[model samples]
Target: MTVVAADAAVSQVDAAAAAASTRPRCSTEDMLQLLQDYDCWVFDLDGTIWRGNEVIEGVLEALELLRKLGKKVLFMTNNSMKSRGSYLDKCLQVGLPAHVDDIYCSSYSAAAYLDSIGFDRSKKAYVVGERGIMQELAAVGIESFGGPDDNEKRASFSSEMLHDTQVGAVVCGVDPNLSYYKVQYASMCLLLNPGCLFIATNTDARGHFTPNLEWAGAGATVGAIKGVVERDPIVTGKPSPFLMQDIAAKHNVQPAKSIMVGDRLDTDILWGLNTGMATLLVMTGVTDEQLLVAQRGSSNGVKPHFVMDSFGDLRRVAQQALQQQK
Candidate 1:
């Protein structure tokens, strides 16, 4: 062919590719076929599944579909304000059926890890955060307690617990009602035990539901405590391997075959992308489509292979993958 003819042919190809790009996307089957290349499902809570007291539409259906398909599903969250039991209650409240074993929290991971390293928590503990952190410590078979005693079951707390105990380690999490005593106690413990591990559930500054005015999550609190004591905390939540390790160790999830689905680009998506796992960004929570796409353009490695508006959407995608395999 002549040179001019060759140039014309290339232009036509370019136009065809552009036209296909702007065309409507694939159906649910297409999406699943694309996603089923791998098989692990790691879901994030708060915004992706539920916001405040309301469950996101199609969430339960999505989870149910995943289970029926025999896909490995695990629930993971950075919120340290609640323990696994608290998460269990939240799941029930939101109409998502989940057992305690199915959910993983930062506090649970942090406490279990600390216990494995030979920190005896069952004797006496000086807690620095909320009910969730305390709940996790209790689950680790550690005897740590914080604040004051109001009755038999609950540890009615004040700033006094910081002054009362000999101290082992300092745990940090969201305590919206964070009293001055809590901070004082944490600082005191750090001052006493410089070798104490400072474990924080997450560093997210805001809550998904409320986004409170005084919001500075466990990360900020850890900073404050560290500043006073001149130390740094070991974070175990989003963008960290702590929660991922917890799930893989306890569950049958295979990272090579697993994918992380979350609403937040910084936490859930980043966790997977950075750690060599497949990532899917859902529009139901903290991050929507626009935000993630924009981040992908700016950051070198922030894009999820799959972008979804709802968990229900994944059901179709799963079926498609199964079909494609055959």
Candidate 2:
């Protein structure tokens, strides 16, 4: 080849190498390096770790390996139906290694948000959720009423109920026992009280309760209240920076040195991106390979830095790395 042609080819090769180095690693071949690169690993719970009541295969093993490697692990979930203590219990029940401090659920986030805002201690909150929300609120010394109790109190909407101005905030989450009365009370609390806060644990559209069905999630309840009140709620779950910022500050986690692994692009991946952390998309729950591929091809899509078929793959990668070292 001519000297000029050889020089041009070498330049092209160097340029390609530089471009490749700048791109995020997606291939499984780089999993070992990724495992070593991050100091902290943040995981999305529901889809990435477990679906319904069953734990995903190899998840426990992977978590054990991460702990062995001295990596800081934290579980973050948008499921506001349960408190952090309940989530810790679920993790222990499923044989997953976890600590209550390492778990951050939307239920806790909502309470923390209220605490951060200097909510009046004397005023009570009208809860349109499960016991989890109530538990977290109480833990922070915030009194709440109207969760399951309101479900059975399906009395006619009385204007007198709105006259009670003790309710300073209206907190909503996924409630299987949601009733019109609960909605009516929560809506009235927000409408009548001038400074009554409207807070939603999350706005997730669907939840996985059973293996075959998708149940209406907190968004359904949040939407119901939003539709009636004509006001946007302050969301405290995934894709919201409040929880992420709190975690970073409290845990001293550096975004650059942490990786967020989750199953959903919109919530999990988007949350990671919003918080300046590396993101890994796992196809174990709500997201599938087809959906991931389509998202990657979309012009304005949010893509993860890495993609794994399942979180279990991390266990396999760790095993392989260990074997290679031996």
Q: Clashes in candidate 2: how many?
A: 0
lDDT of 2 at 150: 73
Question: How much RMSD separates candidate 2 from the native structure?
Answer: 9.7
RMSD of 1: 10.1
TM-score versus the correct structure, for each prediction? 0.78, 0.88
lDDT of 1 by residue, 11-68 (tens): 4554443343322223565466545555678888866777667676677876776766
Q: Which predicted model would earn the best TM-score?
A: 2
TM-score of 1: 0.78
Score residue 149 of candidate 2 by CA lDDT.
Answer: 72
Clash pairs for candidate 2: none
Off by over 4 Å in 1: 1-30, 121-124, 147-165, 211-215, 288-294, 299-301, 315-326
Off by over 4 Å in 2: 1-26, 157-163, 323-326
